[model samples]
Target: MATEQPRSSGSNTQRPLTSALAQHTQKKQWKDLSTPEKVVTATKTTTNYAVIATGAVLVAAIGYAIVSELFGSNSDTRIFGDALEKVRNNDQLQEIIGTPMMGHGEASSSKRRRNRRIHSQVVLDAEGKEHLLMRFYVEGPDNEGIAHLEMVKDQRNKWEYKYLFVDIPGGVRRAQRIFVEYNKDAGLPAIDDK
Candidate 1:
């Protein structure tokens, strides 16, 4: 077989893919950006991390607030064992809260630490009637329970049970509210005008 000769450096000579790539790389321009842009440019990659961190913190706070409002709050010390003991005296309360999942149970370390309080408050309605608010979480291994109970008080300071609802958050926000309304209806008897 005849050996082929090497081509001379002319237009007919073709460059390899690697050499073409090495030749065509255009450098990006560095310019003075606006204050915001400068802050963003100086910390281009770092900014993503910073923004993500800030967003993460914000999300955590909002999550905490929503959980606190519905389940319980930190400022409200009336919760868990204490709330259970007090509510036990009422027949209506005992029936609603007493379930197979009512006994001693352990939850995840995160949940055990976060929702430690049972929310309790007093509010007046348009009729100037004072109402008591009680909300708490009773979490078991497979079950996470939310109890929202309201009791009204008269001038003589006697409490009248108003509404009772028990449900599980199921880790889904939409389902939690649905269960709240559903449990409240199923667990309580409708008031009669008689």
Candidate 2:
């Protein structure tokens, strides 16, 4: 008999059940999220930083390559310039100057007509070798074309001409012709055209 004991207001079973329902609700909401949405959100934040870093590295590499190429020891200008300096201080030009000169090809004729004046200067080194600097002035040409030729003593103590700018028309060839003619008078072999 009697009435059952009144249930206690503080009940562990009820509390646990309520907390469990709340946890279940939170877990279901979290689990229902789309996979693609999560992935895209995460990628969007990380990819931007990754792309910017990659671009910066690529730009730096390209810049370094260009600068290294320009200033490298094996650069064409460095080697050619050094060879030209040696030619300037040699003693071969004096011996070659007195010899007969050959005419440049048909092109020279037309160029000569266009260029009304041909101005040339010669500077001698301590060894008596001559460095020739010539400029051609054309009546209608906007800019003058200049040629620099340096004659130096080779290992055989003979004179040889080295051209400063190889791209110029007849620059190296003319120097070779002059060297050959002068060396021929001295009973030496003609300069090879290699």
Candidate 3:
């Protein structure tokens, strides 16, 4: 006769993954988190987030400056001044004629747009002279919009406009923001103040 072996109890059987996870979650003392405890946790989390965000912004600012130094110019004030000088002289055709106009000027358009500031990028042409890609903005209506062009400095140090008008909307706007951030102390375009 063969001896019969007893079966092990079902309690010893392994639980399903889902039931195990449920048990693990149920074990947490979520209700034990009192109002004050919750507040503290919330405050800590908020402060941590704020610190991280500020750090990230600082690092990004530093990175932007470095990249701008490499790909862009460190001194954009000179570019802005040059553009203004060209506009003032009226002797430069490129600055006068090449300057973009939205449409036939209305009577209200006689009001010259104020707060005209330039975001400049210095590029080298085949001639090896440092040329500026200037993005200028106005404080007038949205219709006033923005303008971008390349202006080169002649031997006399006078800026002569080049054949450049960037009609790109979003890209130019983004570039303006990046340039402003790159030059942190530089005044923002009047549009951004709003």
Top candidate (lDDT): 1
Full ranking by TM-score: 1, 2, 3
Candidates in order have lDDT scores of 0.53, 0.42, 0.49
Count clashing residue pairs per candidate. 0, 0, 0
Candidate 3 has a TM-score of 0.27
Residue-wise C-alpha lDDT for candidate 2, range 130-179, written one tens digit per residue = 44443321111111122343444444554354443212224333423222
The deviation in Å at residue 176 for candidate 2 is 3.1
Cα displacement (angstroms), candidate 3, residue 192, comes to 45
Model 1, 76-151: lDDT tens digits are: 3433444454434444334444443342223436745653434567788787776777776554334445666666
Best TM-score goes to which candidate? 1
Candidate 3 local lDDT, 1-194, one digit each (tens):
99998676667776455776677766336578889878887899999999999999999999998776455533465555444443333323222234432322112443575433345567776857767676664222232334455656655555555543323234323322111112222222235445
Listed per candidate, the RMSD to the true structure in angstroms reads 15.4, 20.0, 18.7
Which residue pairs show collisions in model 2? none
Off by over 4 Å in 2: 1-38, 88-194
By lDDT: ranked, best first? 1, 3, 2
